[model samples]
Target: MMKIKRKSLFTVFLLSMFILSIVPMSAENVEIYSMEKLLDMYIENSHDIEIMELEYELTELKYQIESDDLDNKERQMTRDKDDFYDTKDNSSSQKNIDEKRDEYYASAKAYAASTKDLMIQEFEIKNQDKYVANDTAKKKNSFKNDLWQLYELDKQLEVLNATSDLYKSKYEVAQLSYSLENMTESDLNQALIDYEQMVLNSDTLINNLDMLKGNVYINLGIEPEGEPQFDIVPPQSISPVNITYNDLLSSHKSNSLDYEKQSYSLEAEKVYFDILAGVFLENSDDYQENLNNYKKVQLDFYNYEKELDQMVLDVYYNYQKTIDDYNYAKDTVELAQRQYNEAETAFEVGQISALDMDGAKLQLLNAELTYDQSLISCAKATDEIALLMDGISIK
Candidate 1:
C-alpha cells in the first residue's frame, strides 16, 4: 500500500512538470494588431516578396547552368591541348593548339562573366529584401492613415445624425406654425426640403462609411464584429525629421531597388557585349549592332538615374505643400471654433435661431474634419519619403 501511494504521488509530480513546461506553448492568439506585428505579417506574406523569392531562385539556376557550361568547356580544352601535343601532322597540330588556346580564353572570359552574374544576383537579392521591407512599411503607414480617416468618419456621422435630428425637429415645429397660419407656405416648404436633404445626406454618409470600413477590413485581412475602433494618438507635430534633397538623392541612388535592377541589366548587357566583341571584328555588323545596343542601354540607365532623382524631388515638394495645407487647415479650425463660440452666444441670447446655431456647429465639425484630413496627409507623405529613403517600418 505504501508503494502504491508513492507511485500516485510520482504520477502527479510528472503531470505537473509536463503541464508547467508546455504552458507557454498554449498562449492565446493576438486579436488586435499593433503596427509592428502588422508589418511583420505583411513582410512575410506579401505577393511581392513571394515573387522576389522566385526570381532569386531562377537566377541561381541560371548561374548553375553557366558554371556547368564553363566546367565542360575547360575539360574539352584540356583534351584538345593534349591531342595537339600528341598529333604527328604539323599543320594539324598547330591548328589544334590554336583552337584549344582560343577555347581556353573564351571559356575563361565566360567563367569570369558568370562569376559577375552570380554577384549581380546576390546584390539583387539584397536589394529585393530592402524593397520588400520598404513596401511593407509604406503599406502599413497607409493603413494607419486609412484607420485615422475611418475614425474621423465616425465623428462626421455623428455630426450628420445631429444635424438630421435638429432639422426633423425644426420641420415639425415649422409644420405646426404653417397649419396655424403663423408661418408662410414657402417657409414651411423650405423647412421640409431642408429636413429631407439632411436625411438624404445621412443615408449617403452611412453608405460611404460602410464601404470605407470594408476597405479597411480588406487591407487588414481581418473580420470585425462591428465597426472596428482605432486607438489614435494625435500627432504632436505634423512635420517629419529634416531631410535635405542632396541627402535624399544620395541614399536613393545607392539603395533604390529600381535603380539597382536597371544597373544589373546594364551590367548583363556589358557582359554579353564583351563576349560578342571578343568573337567578332569591331567593323563587323554584329559587333557594331551590339555596340550601338550597349550605348543605348547605357544612355537609358543614365536617364533613369535622373528620373529617380526627380522622383525624390517630387516627393519632397509634395510633402512641403502638404505641410502648408496642414498649417492652413489649423488656422481654419481656429477660425471655425471662434465663429461657433460666437454663434452659441448669439443663440443663447435669442439673437439667432436654433437652425442658425446648428449651421455654425456643422461648420465647426467640417473644419475639424478637414484639419484632421490634412494632418493625416502630412503624416502619410512623411512616411512615404521615409519608405523611399530609409526602408524601415514606422513602428
Candidate 2:
C-alpha cells in the first residue's frame, strides 16, 4: 500500500508539471500598443494601398494619352488644310478662303483642347478630393474607439490568465492540504482537473492574441517583426454639405467612376450595334469582325452597370448593419460589466455559489469579445463607405 501511494503521488507530480508547462513564458513581457499606433503601422505596411496608388498612376497615364490623341487630331486637321490649299487652283487661292480654313481649324482645335483639358482637370480634382475627404482624422478617432475595445479584451484575458494562475496555486494548496490530512482525495482530484482546464483556457487566450497581431501585420503590410507606430495628424475640417442621400445618389449616378465607365461602355456598344446593323460594313470580313467586337463591348457595358448598382446597394446595407451591431455591442458590454460587479459582490458575501460567479464572469468575457468584434465591424463599414464614395486615399 505504501509503494502504491508513492506511485500515485509521483503520477500527480508529473501531471502538475505538465499543467505548468502550458503557462506562457513571454505573456507578461509582450508589448501592448494603442489602436492609433496599430492603424498607422498597418497603413505604412499595407501592400493594398501601394497597389491602389499604382492604379491611380496608370489612370493618369491613360488621361495623358487621351490628351495627346486630341492634340494629334488637331495637328492632322492643320496638315489637311495645307494639303487642300496646295492642290487648289492658284486663281481661286483667295486669302479669304485660306483665312476661313485657318479659322475652322482653330475653332476645332480649341474645342477639342477645351474638352480634353476639362476631362483631365476634372479627373485630377476628383483624385485630390478623394484624398482630402478620406477620414484620416476620423481614423484616429476610430482607432481611439477600437483602443477601448482592445483594452476591454486585454482586461478579460488578463483575468482569465490570473484565474488560471489562481487554479494552479489552489492545486498546490490542495496537495499540501492532503499531506496535512485536511483535504480528501476527491477534493485534490477536482482541484487538479480545474487547474488543467484553466491552463488550457490561458493557452487559448494567448493564441488568440497572437492571431490578432498577425492580422494587424497583414493589414499594415508590415513584417511580423516590424515595430508599429502611429502619427496623429489632425484633419483640416470642412464645411458640412446640406446634400441629402438622394442628392448624393443623383450626383454619383453620373459622377461615379463605375457609372462613368458604364456610360462610356454603353456608348461604345451603341456604335457596335450600328456596325452590326451593317451601317459601316465594307466587303471585308475583317471589318465585320471588328463590328462584332464593338457589339460585344456594348453588351459588357450593360452587364457592368447592373453589377455596379448591386454592389452599391450591398455596401450600403452592410454599413448600416455594422453601425447597428456596434451600438448593440457597446450597450451590452455596459450591462455585462454591471452584472459582473453584482455577482462578484454577491459571491464574496456568500450570497451566491461559485458556479454563479463563474457564469457572471463568462458573460462579461463574452461581452468584451463581442464589443471588440463590433469595433472591427465598424471600421470595416467606414472603409466601405469611403470606397463607395471613391474617397479612399491612394497611398
Candidate 3:
C-alpha cells in the first residue's frame, strides 16, 4: 500500500510539470504583430482595396470580350475580302462580282466601327486600372498615417503613466511628512491634488487609447475583443536618409502619379490635335479649341515637374529638421542625466531630501521621454519621405 501511494504521488508530480510546460506554449500562441505585419494586415483587410480590385477585374473582363469581338470582326472582314477576290477569279458573272465587292466594303466599314468602339473600351479599362492602383496607394498612406498617430498617442500614454507613478510617490511621501509634522497641511493637499490630476489624465489617455484601438480593429475587419494584443516598438536611433537629393528627385519624377497622368493627357491631346489638323483648318473653331487643349496640357506637364522638384526639396528639409530636433533632445537627456547623478550624490550625503531627488529623477524621465519622442518623429519623417518617393500620394 505504501509503494502504491508513492507511485501515485510521483505520477501526480509528473503531470503537474507537464501542465506547466504546456501552459507557456499556450500563452505564447498570442500573436504579436510587428509594425510591418500590422501594415500588411491592414492592407490585406481593406474593404476599399478589395472592392477596387473586384471592379478592375470586371472591367478587364468586359474589355476582354470587346477585344475578342474586335478580333472576330477583323477576321470576318478579311474573309469577306477574300471571298470578293475569289469571285473575281472564278465567278465570271458581273452581277455576282459586284455583290461580293459591295459585301466586302460593308464588312470593312463595320470592322472600322467595332475597332473604334474597342479603342474607347480599352482606354476606359486602362483608366479604371489606374484609378484602382492610385486608390490602393492612398489607402496605404492612410494606414501609415493612422498607425503613426496611434504610436504617438501610445508614447504620450507612456510618459503620462510614468508621471502618474511619480505623482503617487510624491503624494505618499507628502502624507508621511504631514503626519510627522514636517510638511504643512496646505502642501499635503496640493500633493494630493497633483496625484489626482495625474490619475485623471492617465484615465483620459487610457480611454483615448482604447478608442483608437477600436477604430484600428474596425478598419482591419477585426473584432476588438477577439484580436490578439500587439506592440509597436518605436525606432530607438535616428536613421538618416542615405541617398542624395538628386536620387530622391529622380525617384519622385519616375513614380509621380501627377506626372504620369499629365504626360498621358498631353500625349492624348497631341493625338487629338493631329486628328483635327487632318480634318480641319488651323483657324477652324474645333481645331483651335483642340490646339489650346494641347498647349494647356503641355503647360501643366511643365508646372508639375517644377512642383515635384520643390516637393522633394521640402521633404528633405523636413527630414533634416527632425534630425536636428533629435540631436537637441539627446543633448537635453545628457544634461538631465548629469542633474540626476548630482541629485543622487547629494541625497546620499544628506544634502537634499528624498523629494528633491525624486524631482531630479522625474526630470530625467521627462527628458528621456522627450528624446524618445524626437527619435520617433525622426523615424516617421524618414518613412514619410520614403513613401513619397515610392509614389504614394492622394492626387
Candidate 4:
C-alpha cells in the first residue's frame, strides 16, 4: 500500500473562471447565444445606454438646427446690407459694407463651430454603441469561461463520485477485516483517510459549482427565475478569418469615429481662421490665442492618430500570443486524454486504486478546462479586434 499526497483542489479558484465569482444571478436556462446575438440583446433593453443614445441624438439635432439658423442669418445680413446701401445710404455704404462683413464673419464662425459640435455628437453616439458592444463582449467572454469550468467540473465531480463510492466500499471492507483480526490498524486508518479525502474533494467541487452558478447569472444580467441551466459547447477547432492585421488596422483607421470627429474639428478651425482673417488685428492677443488653439487641435489630432496606431500594433501582437497559447493548451489536452485512457483501462482491470483513477480524471478535466480557457482568450482577442475595426467580424 502507498500513501498518496492529496493535491490542491483550490487551484481551480485561481483561473479565469474566478473573474465571474462576484456577479449577481440572472435568468435560468437562457438559450445559448453567440457574441453578436448577445450584443443585440444587451442593446435592446439596456436603459443606461439608451439614455446616452438619446442624449447624443438630441444634442446633434439641436446643434445642427442652430448652425443652419446662423448660416441663414449671415446670408440675410449680407442681403439686407446690400439692399440698404443700394437704396438708402449710398454715401456711407463703405462703413455699412465693413460692418456687415464683420457680422457675416462672426456668424460664419458660430455656424462652423456648431457644425463641428454636431459631428462631435455623432461621434459620441457611435462611441456609446461601441461601449455597449464592448461591455457585452467582455461579459459574454466571462460567461463562456464560467460555463467551460462548470462543464469540466461537472464531469470531474461525476468521476469523483465513483471514486468516493469505491473508497467507501474499501473502507467498509477494511472495517470488517479489522473486526475479524485480518487487517492491521495502520491499513484500516489509511482506508479511512482515503475515504475522507474523497469526501472533502467532492465537497470542494460542489462549493465551486455553486459559486459559478451565481456568476453566470450576473453576467447574463437577469435575475435567476429558477435553477439556471447552462448549455455551452466548447470550441473544437480554431476558426480562421480571411483578413490580416494590416487589413484590420486599415479598416479601423477608415471607420474610426474619433478620426472623423478630428477631421470635422480641423475643418471648422480652418473656417474660423478664414472668417477672422480680415476681422482680427494681426498683433492682437485674440489673434494669437485663436492661432494657438488651431495649432493645439492639429497637434492633438496627430497625437490621437499615433495612439491609435500603437494600440493596433499592441492588439495584433497580443492576438498572436493568444493563438500560440491556445495551440499549446490544445496539445496539453491531447496528452491528458491519453493518460486518462490508460488509467481508465487499468481501473477497469482492478490494477489501480479508485483514488488513482480519480486523479487521472482530474488531470484530464483540468486540461480540457485549460483548452476552453484558451478559446475564451481567443474570443476576447477577436472581440477587441472587432471593436477597434468598428464592426469587422472575426471568425
Q: Backbone clashes in each candidate structure, one number apiece?
A: 0, 5, 0, 3
Scored against the true structure, residue 305 in model 3 reaches a CA lDDT of: 76
Q: Model 1's lDDT to the true fold? A: 0.65
Instruction: Specify the poorest-scoring 10-residue window by lDDT in model 1.
Output: 1-10
lDDT of 4 at 116: 54
Alpha-carbon deviation at 62 in model 1, angstroms: 4.3
- For 1-395, candidate 1 gives per-residue lDDT tens digits of 00000011112111110100101112274243344444455445457657866876786687677666766755654664455444524555666666655655455445546655666766665566566556555565555566566656767887888888788988998999999999999999999999999999989988887788777555645455544443343343554547888887777667666666778878887876776576545797756877898899899988987777778888878888888898999999999999999999999999998878888988898898788778767766766666667523232
Q: Tell me the TM-score of model 3.
A: 0.65
Cα RMSD (angstroms) for every candidate in the order listed: 12.9, 16.4, 13.5, 11.3
Candidate 3 residue runs with Cα over 4 Å from true position: 1-32, 61-145, 161-201, 226-230, 255-258
Descending-lDDT candidate ranking: 3, 1, 4, 2
Candidate 3 structure quality by residue, lDDT tens digits, 155-228 = 67777887888889889988999999999999999999999999999899878877876777777666534433
Off by over 4 Å in 2: 1-208, 211-255, 265-292, 390-395
The candidate scoring highest on lDDT is 3
Give model 3's clash tally: 0
TM-score to native of every candidate shown? 0.69, 0.49, 0.65, 0.60
Residues 1-395, candidate 4: write the lDDT tens digits: 10111122212111121222222134253333443343344445446556756776786677677766766756754665465445445555677666665665465456546555655555565577664554544444444445556656665676688778778888988999999999999999999999999999999998888678676555446566556544344444554434577897898778765566667767766766655554456878657767887788789888977877778888777778888999999899999999999999999999998767767877786787778768767655655665566632222
Clash count for candidate 1 is 0
Candidate 4 local lDDT, residue 28: 56
Pairing residues by index, what is the TM-score of model 4? 0.60
Could you tell me which residue pairs clash in candidate 1?
A: none
